[model samples]
Target: MDLGLKGKNAIVTGATRGIGRAIADLLADEGVNVSVCARKADEVAATVSALEAKGVKAFGQVVDIADAAALQGFVRASAEALGGLDILVSNASALVQGARPEDWKAMFEIDILGAVNALDAARPHLEAAAGKTGDAAVVLISSISAAEAAAPSAYGAMKAAQIHFAKGVAREGAPKGLRCNVVSPGTVFFEGGVWGNVKAAMPAFFEQMLKRNPTGRMATPEEIAAATVFLCSPRSAFTTGINMVVDGGISQRANF
Candidate 1:
């Protein structure tokens, strides 16, 4: 029941809303000292306040992960604020648009480059924690799109690259007591946003999405967050360099 998370410090990127926010709240609830970040200063402060209400130490920063230097500064600040870092959840970026040549830049910048920035900056702190308890872990928030073609172009390709890079990081960092793994969520519904955007921008595509999934439903952010926390916990001590997919059987059916 303890989850052994009390006093453990964590950094959750993109923590102002949606899945990142949910993950931050859950970690704080379990007694983890958490530092959350977003590009907006007000949103970061507000999110930290919300987490503080849960009675755990929390910090927030305005970090544009697309900028490596800024993200490094944010990580260092988070470590300084929390006294140390034991867990890192790299949950940054908007799910990029598909592989039109124009979408390439933004997709790679956020999805690929941003991940490199966070993981690199947090390695030292995470390594120190691993040295202390042999349990420090980095959880890369990927998507089920990595395994399927549903998400299309830039998003899907970059995600697949994330998985490969995560594995390489796991192998390199494992010797230093660091662990890295990827968590992929399928069709996560982020209410009042994408679903609605899809309805207005492209209705037929949305309908096809609903029909492709065997469960006739999309996953909630909380459901994905639970799996994410498990990966970060001692519960998954031996799990690394893997992609744990959470899709309502969406990726399994080849012929829908």
Candidate 2:
């Protein structure tokens, strides 16, 4: 299907690696211009170069999405570079694994506030772009943790709040012709990422998750990214304020 994403401008946070990088690449492949950002300047630069080679208009910068001012500046610059913003993928997150309230709070700052800040910063640009093409969307890369408690435990709680935050953005943005939605994924492995550590020592955790999954496998980042790109594209024009779960039936929670 042609997603009808040609020439659209998008901003993808946390786009240097993992799921966010995959999302950016998918958008770029669909002929969308994408601007990416992450805390690592070199990683962002490498990602943008690769996308540009794919014949997509792509650029990037370094920014801590947890910082409102930094996020605002990145959004402004990305909008200007891409000509405007029609799709915003807020995917940056910091996961703190500790059995403490402080860990949860720290995760909230990056996972929840970061997504909200991106939505706020890109709202006006998205509205304008929507006005131009009658299609605009924001896709947040939340996790199944929100719906189910995570191994880290605290991560899931903050992610659940992220979904609600996206819903709220959708409600407020609807009148302006912008749609906001959440994509909650499970077990997306990033190369050399923390999730690998969780999977390594937690044999019981895998068994528990696999027992619940009809697919009997962990979700790949690419799988989740494919769903996300569809949401941002014209294909899912009417979808808004929804959490599209990408778990392998893990969230289904069935009793054997």
Candidate 3:
């Protein structure tokens, strides 16, 4: 299916690895010029090189998403570098699950403010793109934990906050042909990721978690990316203010 993404430009945060990298790769595959940012300079460079090899214009910068000024600067630079921005994917997170004060602070700074800052920086560019093409999109990479609470978790609370933010953005941007949505993944597994670490250090607990999924496995980064990139595409022009869960049936909550 043609995603209608060719010639568009996008910026993705935390694009060096995991789901962020997967989203960037898929956007590039669909002929979108992409600008990516991550904390590691080497990873950012390598990711840019890889994206360029796909025959699309690609740019990357080392950025700390927790720094609002730096992140907003990167977004503006990306729009200028790529000529305009039609898509924005906020995929960076602190991934802090503890109930400590420091953990909450980190999650709020990176997970919540990160998405807010990116959108604030990209709003004008996105609105302009929508004016020309009749569509522009923002996809926030949240988690199914947003709706599930087995304990007090800053991670889950911040994730839930992201959903609320997306909905508001969608409503506000609707008149301008700009859409915002959230992609909430359940237990996504990739090398060096949370689940991967668990699998290596706590095999029994990892196995227990794995068995909870009806699919008998956790989702791959690519799986989550597919859903994300699609939502960012013009193909899903009408899909906005919605949380699309891609959890491989591990999340029991009904989306409706």
Candidate 4:
């Protein structure tokens, strides 16, 4: 299970909690230097400290993903601090599952454009690292909602856009030895996450969703992270331009 991740460096956005945090933690566990960002300053500091405790170089910044300047700044600073970037995980989401204009705007700015800006900033560093290692990856955290049509929401549209965008990035970056892929997780559950709040406020609905999964439960953040970090590893060097669904079979669509 050696992933060839030791000594590599990565940036994971919205990494102070939940799936993003899990991805950063797992990467650090595999000896990858990690730079992470979230909006809260104290949480960022604590996460950075926790990751550093795992014996990998770790950096954190308080960043509002909706702000392109701040998002790009973090990416550039992370690349400088980490010496280079081999992996970039666009894990932030606005979580706006509504049809309003404001909802669409937020999703576009934070979820879609946030990733766009980060990739732009990291492109040079990723290209350089790819030249040396022949393995650089970008894993976008999408959702199964991207393919499923439970309702018309800006969230699903933006998530679908991310998958499409990653496909293009994969094709264009391949010549430079960079791989881009999407990890579409379905109903991942964690404390203070979407499902956790649903369980508290709308028990019946939450139970319905829980029952919908043949596994009798939703995915854990760690499960999604494991898939994501693996795709970002040299172990999956040939994996690109693909949407790897990690939903415990909750998603019925055959990947092929």
Candidate 5:
């Protein structure tokens, strides 16, 4: 199905690999120009080249989302390079799930503040794009862990915070023809990712998690990306301030 996202410009953070990379690639597949950022220069370049292969303009930069200056710079530069911004996907995370104070701080800085800073930097361009296209979107890559916390975890807390933040953003941005939403994914596995490593080093734990999913498997990065892109699409123009959970039944809570 046509997503009506052709020619749109997007900035996706942490797009070097995993779910972020999936989202960026899928956006390019739908004919959207994408600007992506990662800390590693080689990964950034390689991802950009791959996206460009899909016939859309792709830009990449080495950025540390924990650094506010660098994060904002990448956003502004991307908007300029793409001509305007129609979508912003905040997918970067420190992945600090530990209970330590420093872990909490790092998660807050990278996960929560990263999304805030990106939206702030992209607001002008999104507003401008709205003027011409009548719509704009921002999707936060949160996690199901937000509602399903089993222990003291900074990651869960910050992911939950993102959902709250996006709701407020949705209300404020709607008047400007902008939509804001969250995509909370469950355990998603990919090569070289956390789960993949767990599957290799901790086979018993990995099997436990796999069995916990009624589907008998964790979600693929592409599954999460598909949900996110749909929410960001013009076809879902009326959708905002909603957390779309793409967990493949691994998360048992019902949406209220």
Candidate 6:
């Protein structure tokens, strides 16, 4: 299946490890020029080298997603480096699960505002790309926690807010051929990731989470990345304003 993504330019936030890294790699594999940003200079450099090794133009920079100016700057720089931006994926998060006020603030700053800032910075480039290619996309990485509620969680609340934001972008950008969508992953596991740390530190809780998935396990970062990249592809030109859940049946709610 040719994704018709070769030569397209993309920017992915937090594209150094886990799902973000997987998405960046997959995009490179599809022959898309990629620009990535993360806080760690070493990881960002390594990721760029790895992507360039795949024979695609790649750029990276150290960026703090919580800082609006820094994040917007990265996006603009990336668009300039990559020639233009056809896809934008906001994958950075604060990963704050606590109920404290500070935790909520962190999530709002990094997750909510980060997505907003990235879209604002990339909108012009994306719209210009749409003028040339007839399609442009923005994929927001969200989570199944947005639809589920067990306790007070800033993470879930902010994720839900992202979904709402994406919907509005989708509607507003539809006429401009700028698509916006959300990909909600559930219990993604990778080495040194949240689930991996949970499995090592709290085996019982990890096992409980595993059993909750009908697949009898969790999703891999690659699995989530596949869904994300596909949504950004020209083949999915009409797939906008939709929250695609790649949760391995862990989420029970049916999409209407």
TM-scores of all predicted structures: 0.92, 0.91, 0.99, 0.98, 0.99, 0.99
What do the candidate models score in CA lDDT, each in turn?
A: 0.85, 0.84, 0.96, 0.94, 0.94, 0.96
What does candidate 4's lDDT look like per residue over 90-131, in tens digits?
999999999899999999998899999999999999999999
Q: Which stretches of candidate 2 lie over 4 Å from their true place?
A: 150-152, 199-212, 253-256
Q: Per-residue lDDT tens digits of candidate 2, residues 1-256?
A: 7889998999988888888889999888989899999988789889999999989899899897678898888898999988888999988888665659788777878888887788778888998988988879998888877766536577877888888888888888887778989998877665556556556878688567666667877777789999999999888988899998888776765422
The C-alpha stretches of model 6 lying farther than 4 A from their native spots are: none
lDDT of 6 by residue, 1-256 (tens): 9999999999999999999999999999999999999999999999999999999999999998998999999999999999999999999999999889999999999999999999999999999999998999999999999999999999999999999999999999999999999999999999899999999999999999999999999999999999999999999999999999999999899978
Candidate 4: segments with Cα more than 4 A from true spot = none
Write one digit per residue (lDDT tens) for candidate 1, span 39-134: 889999999999899998899888878888998998999999999999999888657766887677777888788888887888889989989988
lDDT for 148 (candidate 6): 92
- The best-first sequence of candidates by lDDT reads 6, 3, 4, 5, 1, 2
Total backbone collisions, model 5:
0
Q: How close is candidate 4 to the true structure, as a TM-score?
A: 0.98
Cα deviation at 123, candidate 3, in Å, is: 0.6
Residue 94, model 5: Cα distance from true site in angstroms: 0.7
Worst lDDT run of 10 residues, candidate 6, spans 247-256
Deviation of model 5 at 10, angstroms: 0.4
As for candidate 2, its clashing pairs are none
- Top candidate (lDDT): 6
RMSD of each: 2.6, 2.7, 0.6, 0.8, 0.7, 0.6
Residue pairs of candidate 5 with colliding backbone atoms = none
